[model samples]
Target chain A: MKDVILGIDIGGTNTKFGFLDRDGISLVQGELSTNEGETVHDFLRVLYQEVMTKFKKIEDEANLIGVGVGAPNGNYYTGTIENAPNLKWHGSVPLVDLLKQYFKMPVFLTNDANAAAIGEMVYGGAKNMNNFVVITLGTGLGSGIVVNGQLVYGHDGNAGEIGHTLVNVNGRGRMCGCGRKGCLETYVSATGIKRTVYKLLADSTDYSELRSVSFNDLTAEMITQAAKRGDKIAIDAFEYTGKVLGMKLADTVAHLSPEAIFLFGGLVRAEEFLFDPVRYHMEKNLLHIFKGKVKILPSGLGLNNTAVMGAAALAWNEMERGATA
Target chain B: MKDVILGIDIGGTNTKFGFLDRDGISLVQGELSTNEGETVHDFLRVLYQEVMTKFKKIEDEANLIGVGVGAPNGNYYTGTIENAPNLKWHGSVPLVDLLKQYFKMPVFLTNDANAAAIGEMVYGGAKNMNNFVVITLGTGLGSGIVVNGQLVYGHDGNAGEIGHTLVNVNGRGRMCGCGRKGCLETYVSATGIKRTVYKLLADSTDYSELRSVSFNDLTAEMITQAAKRGDKIAIDAFEYTGKVLGMKLADTVAHLSPEAIFLFGGLVRAEEFLFDPVRYHMEKNLLHIFKGKVKILPSGLGLNNTAVMGAAALAWNEMERGATA
Candidate 1:
């Protein structure tokens, strides 16, 4: 029988699952509503049922060897999901423990960004790198730092929180869900660009297509589309976001000295509109020694497959290290 | 004969050497002028002669096993010191190769801060910690980041340069010897406090004993003494320095999630004058998840012998890892 690992990515809106072989080739994949069940246990039960139904289709040819999961606030060390804001689960939920009841295979989990980093190392552009950072830019920013070929879980399970570091310290700046002001995420994420567009509309008299979009209705895709059409406010928003991200990344380089920083998630789709300014400002702000040494690249697993592949990569990595169920 | 490792710390002003047992006990320690020779080879020759003479006194009880040297801009991966601004060497100098000519044993070389970090792990307060940061506050700030009980050497072996990260982004700030402005060290080191005192003296009309001292004559020790005596300007300088250092450290904690941060060197002698504000501000700025979790502690290796112990620890550590000359 062909050996396979199960990869699961639990997001706020949907939960995606896939079965893949050692080379990261998916045999089957599908998604379900994350809130289909009333409780955490109910959700996991449904997920397990859905996964088993999918696995049975290939049961004769493929063998299910292990399971891996990626989710917000997932703790690699504790095997729990700790109060992830986007999910309905409000307290520490023993995710691994619940999953173990369904699958008698080695199970591992980590925060989505860390899983993405592992995926990058095992299957993407960072295959040869021992030290690098992965930045996930979605609704909010998330990061995964790798050093000496191992993910840095830090002293606690929650080490990669680069999003929350301050960008402005002098005055009360942008408010963040974490209740902090002037955070890097407040200026660099998809929501960050939307916020920046509004601020630009307020400050500049220049005609912009974004001027008509309601604050709640505006999206990063709309802004990118507008910038492509020569919208001044949208273009300025991307520039400002890049400036903030580049400067903070320069600081990150000083701290971790990663070989490269990989940018993933939605905002990266802006392509050169985003990459150009980020590369420019990151180089401009980098210390002389770090100049031209660090590369900024896109996620290599392809955007559609990142979450699943990340989870799969985590499972494979843990199993190789001799971790048991 | 008892085995001992030779530890050498080459500073701008002096080169200190010590022979230490595995238990971190010093067999003998001494210092010599760093620039007594006209060239790099001459300096190494004189250093070798001085170390040999010192070893003769303890030769009956000690057997030399290996050597470890720490200097500014030292590279562990390359075993070279790369154009350190404070050192007279203008280009890459093969420090390990030069030291090998004398001992014929295993030789290791790394930056002073990295050596100190290894010392902290092997002998100091962080003996039990797997992730921690060490900040050396002297003429300029230097840092060593320990993740998973190993120093982060980055891609080019210059990972821990937190001192060069920016604390300011607007206007022309204090100039750094590294040709950058507004670096963290420019505001938080020994010379940083002096610059702060001068700025404070110029900004306010408060009565102060520091008003009589010139910039060149002023020192961090003098500032500590003045603050102890209730001199307002001196006290305010320490407060400002603490505020900046604490804020930056909060960001560091966010990135690394280190269990504790150890402050070392001359500036730490300010005691509560520095620690109080740093703790308060760091606590005030830390993310809720990290709040009250990370500790700010003094270096457990003490002040006078830290360099020697650090280098000794590096040598022993490398020997255990099977690195040889």
Candidate 2:
């Protein structure tokens, strides 16, 4: 039987699962609603039932190898999911312990951003790079830094927190949900783009399709659509967001000197509208020594497949390391 | 016979040489003036004479294993010093090729900042760490970043040029020597401190020992002495410098997440006057996830012996790597 591994991507809203083979191919994929019930245990029970049913059907054709998980606040060192913001789970959840009961094999877990970095390294754009950084711009900004061909997990597995670096010391102090002021995420995320649009609308009399949308009603897709149609206000909002992000990226490049920086997540889909401005400002702000050298590219893996592939890559990396040792 | 390495520190004005054992113990150290009137070939003749005298004296006591030289624009990949700004040498000086006439064994060359990083890794404070950054605050700011226990040499072997990163986009637009405007080095170096002192003097009519000193006459040591004696303007100069450095460091930490940052060079002698303010602002600007976690520490190695020790460490590292490979 061919060897297969279980890959899981745990989100606050939904949990995605896939059966991945040795060659980085996914045979089946499924998803379930998360945080719908009162407790994490309730969600786990239903998730296990669905996974078991799926696995049994494939057991005749594939041999189960192990399980890997990617989630918010997942700790590679401790195998637990700590108190992640926006999620109903309050305390440390022993995810590896719970998953062990379902599959009796080696299990690995890491933060979602880190998992994405591993995915890029193993099967996507960063396959040839030994050092690179991955930035995920969604509802919030997330990052995973790869140094010397390995993920950097500091003392408490909280090393990759690039989103929280302050870009503007005195300009429009927006409080990040992380309790920080003027963080990169405060000006670069989808939430940040909406904030910029609202601020621009309030300050100027610029007419646009987005002027009617409420704060809760505004979405990144709408802004991208309007910008594509030559909406001045929408275009300005993306430019403003990209400038802040590019400046922050310049500072990051000075420190890491990575071969490349990979962008992932939903907001990156805006493509040229966001990337052109970001690239221009990043090069403009970069030091002469690093200018025109570092490549900033989008992740090649699809959203649904990347997380699962990354989780599986973590197990594969561990296995390789163990074999070498 | 005991294994010994020749350590050479090539400064723009003077070249220091020392004989060291594997344990980093210096047997003998001396300095030679690099006469500006002499051509590159003439200067090497003088350097070789001094090296021969020292080697002859110790030839019976130790076995000469290798030679390592650290200089301003040294490139490890090419083993050459390329267009060092302060030195009269105008083009690529193949240092390893020159050294081969005297020693037949391995000869290595790297930039001074990288040498200092190797110093910390082999015999100083960073012995236990695999990830850290070393900042040399001398005439100008120079840095060496180590990620995952290896030195990062970019495509052109000119990585770790953090000082050239722009800290202020629209503030004082001072032209950097690198043909850039408002670089971090333009505001954080010894020259930067003097500029700040002059700016402070012009802004305030306060009594200061610094007021009478001309820009060409002022020195970093004098500024430190005045700040230690409660000179308000002098104290403020250091605080201003530290604030810029701290904010820039916060941005750096967000990218690499190094375990610690090591400071070296003559300017770092200000110690508390500079460190206190740097520490305060760094902690203040850091993300909550990294606050109070990373450390800012002074170089444990003595200034008088650091150059030779650092060069010696480079030789040791090269030898070890060769053996392992």
Candidate 3:
């Protein structure tokens, strides 16, 4: 029988599971509610039940090789979801161990952000790059740093917290969801654009459409649409957000010296509205050796399939390196 | 014959070469003026001639296995010293090829700071660690970032420039030797402390022993002596220096999540004056997950012999990696 691996992305809202051969082509796909209960057992049970139906039909056609999982706070070392704040699960959950009992196959797990980085490396533009960064710009900024072609999971499994790194170290700036002040995410994420827009409305006297909107009413999509129509406040918000992101990324460039930085998420859909200012400011602030040297590119993975692809790529990588390694 | 490897540390004023066993015991050592002429050819000739005398005597007892040279702006990938400003050589110098023509042994090269890092990994506190950073607090702050038990050379072999990373992004800050403003080194190195003192002298009315001195007349040693004697300005300078260094290092901890950050240089001789504030500010600024977890410790290597040990360790590492690797 032909061999295939299962990729599962356990997100806050939904869990997406898909089966793909070692070649990355999907053989089957589906999703289940991740918040169905506090534990992941319910979701995995339903996912497996659905997959088993397909597996029995394909028994003579394909073989299940292993399973790969991606989740917030997922630890590659422990294969546990360690108190991921977004998930219904409150504390460290042994989701991988639970999956293994159901799937009865070799299991591998890593943080969702790191899985995305591996996806970029395996099936994206970074296939040839050994050093690069993958940044997810969703509600908050999530980052995965790759060095020498391996994800940098530091002393703790929580090595890729670039969002929380300080940007404005001066007086009390924006407060972050992480309970920190002046975090990079406080100024650069989807929520960050709203924060910037709020600040811009308060600080500037320019006539703008954003001034009419309340904090709860303002959305990143609305701001992008406004900027596309040449709204000064909306455009300024992206520029300011890009300025902060580019400057902080310049610092990251100094620290890790990655060959490129990959942008993934809805913010990337803004195209030049976000990319232009980020490139401008990152280059403008970088050291001479790094100035104009690093590339900022969109992720090669499709936006909808990114998380699942990341998990699949992780399995493919483990297969190549031997699961134990 | 007893096996030996030659370790060379080329400084702006002095070039030191020493022969050592795989175990790192120095067998023969000597130094010569590096600026014998405008070119490295003359310097290498004098260096080789002095070393030949020792080699001939040890010919019956030792066999030379390899050579490792550490120089400013040294590129490990190319084995070339690219535009090292401190050296008499004006542009890129193929020192490895030149050394090979003379010594006839496999040669390895990296920046002086990276060499120090390898030294720490081989003979110092980071022997077993796969991730750590070695920061050299010298004429200018130099850093070598070790991730996954190897130095991060980036794409251009210039990855560790933590010194040059922006610490002060405010209005036109202190100008750095590299022509950048507000570089961490401008405020944290031997010269950096002096710069801080100069600023403190200009900005503050607080009286101290430092007021009696001019910029050229002052030295880092004097500041340490004053701080040791409980002089307020000197003590404040070290505190401020450590505060800045520690805060920036917190950002680094966020990036690489190194297990321990090893401090090396003359400033470290101040002991608690520097280390105390660095630890304090680093912890104060670190994210909660990383807070109180990362260790900031003094390097285990001797100050005078660190460069030598580092180069020796590089050769030993190369030998173990099968030279060709």
Q: TM-score for all predictions?
A: 0.98, 0.94, 0.97
Q: Give candidate 2 regions above 4 Å deviation.
A: A36-42, A170-172, A323-325, B35-42, B97-102, B170-172, B323-325
**Which pairs clash (backbone N, Cα, C closer than 3 Å) in model 1?**
none
Superposed model 1: Cα runs more than 4 Å off? B170-172
Docking class of 3: medium
The window of 10 residues in a row where model 3 chain B has the poorest summed lDDT is B164-173
lDDT of 2 by residue, A1-325 (tens): 8888788989878888888886789877788897656787888888888887788888888887778799998988789998888678888999888878767788889999899998888888988887788998888898998877888776457778888877766433798987778888988888999999998988889789898899999998888898999888889999998888887788778766788889898777788989988898898888776789888898967665687888887777766667211
Query: lDDT of all predictions, in order shown?
Result: 0.90, 0.83, 0.86
Per-model fnat list = 0.73, 0.42, 0.65
DockQ for the candidate 1 complex? 0.82
Reference-based TM-score, model 3: 0.97
The alpha-carbon lDDT assigned to residue A34 of candidate 2 equals 78
Give the local distance difference test score of model 3.
Answer: 0.86
> lDDT tens digits, residues A1-325, model 1?
9888999999999999999888889999989999987999889888888998998899999988899999999999899999999999889999999999888888998999999999998888899999999999999999999999999999998898999888877436899899879889999999998889888888889998777779889999999898889888888899999988988898899998889999999888888888888898888777898999999999887788789899999998888878775
DockQ, 0 to 1 scale, candidate 3:
0.77
lDDT of 1 by residue, B149-168 (tens): 88889988989889988887
Model 3 misplacement above 4 A:
A54-60, A205-214, B323-325
Residue lDDT tens for model 3, A29-77: 8787876744567766777787787677667877888888999889988
Q: RMSD in angstroms, all models?
A: 1.2, 2.5, 1.7
Question: What lDDT score is found at residue A262 in candidate 3?
Answer: 94
